[model samples]
Target: MGRFIALMILVIPAVIAGYGIKLMRDTIFTLLNTPYPNLSVQFIAGFILFLAGLGFIGGFIFHRDKKNGKIAPRFKRRK
Candidate 1:
């Protein structure tokens, strides 16, 4: 049950980010003939989603690995 919820949390943002990338790609191709290609909110939203999703996944990995001692603590000073 917990794992399912965790997977859902990771997947939802990834799906949103993927949709955003598709929207931006289509917008760019459709506007390729225009003299001045302008960016729409969809592009910005997609970028944000992509970054947020990456961050979430990275953090989850770090947390999980740290628990198993496979990775060092993020804030600990290595001497």
Candidate 2:
């Protein structure tokens, strides 16, 4: 149950990241999405979304690694 919940939480960010990629690609191909007024807006929004999702996932993994002492010694909390 715990693992399932964790997976569900992760899925949302993954989907958001995927959609961001799609939006960026569309902008590059000159395909306009109605919700966005222009290519610049779409591209910017996509970039932000992609970074946000990536940051969240990266932070989660980093936290887990820190807890398990799997990361570099320099990153570990100092006593």
Against the true structure, whose lDDT is highest?
A: 2
Per-residue alpha-carbon lDDT of candidate 1 for residues 1-79, written as tens digits (9 for 90 to 100): 9999999988987787676676668567754323324557656665776787778788887778777788756655489
- Error at 59, model 2, angstroms: 0.6
Cα TM-score of candidate 1: 0.66
Residue pairs in candidate 1 whose N, alpha carbon or C atoms collide under 3 angstroms: none
Candidate 1's displacement at residue 79, Å, is 10
Q: What are the clash counts of all predictions, listed in order?
A: 0, 0
Off by over 4 Å in 2: none
TM-score, cand. 2: 0.94
Instruction: Show the lowest summed lDDT stretch of 10 residues, model 2.
Output: 5-14
Residue lDDT tens for model 2, 1-79? 9999889878888888888999999999999999999999999999988998888888888998888889998998799
In candidate 2, clashing pairs total 0
- Minimum summed lDDT over a 10-residue window in model 1 is located at 30-39
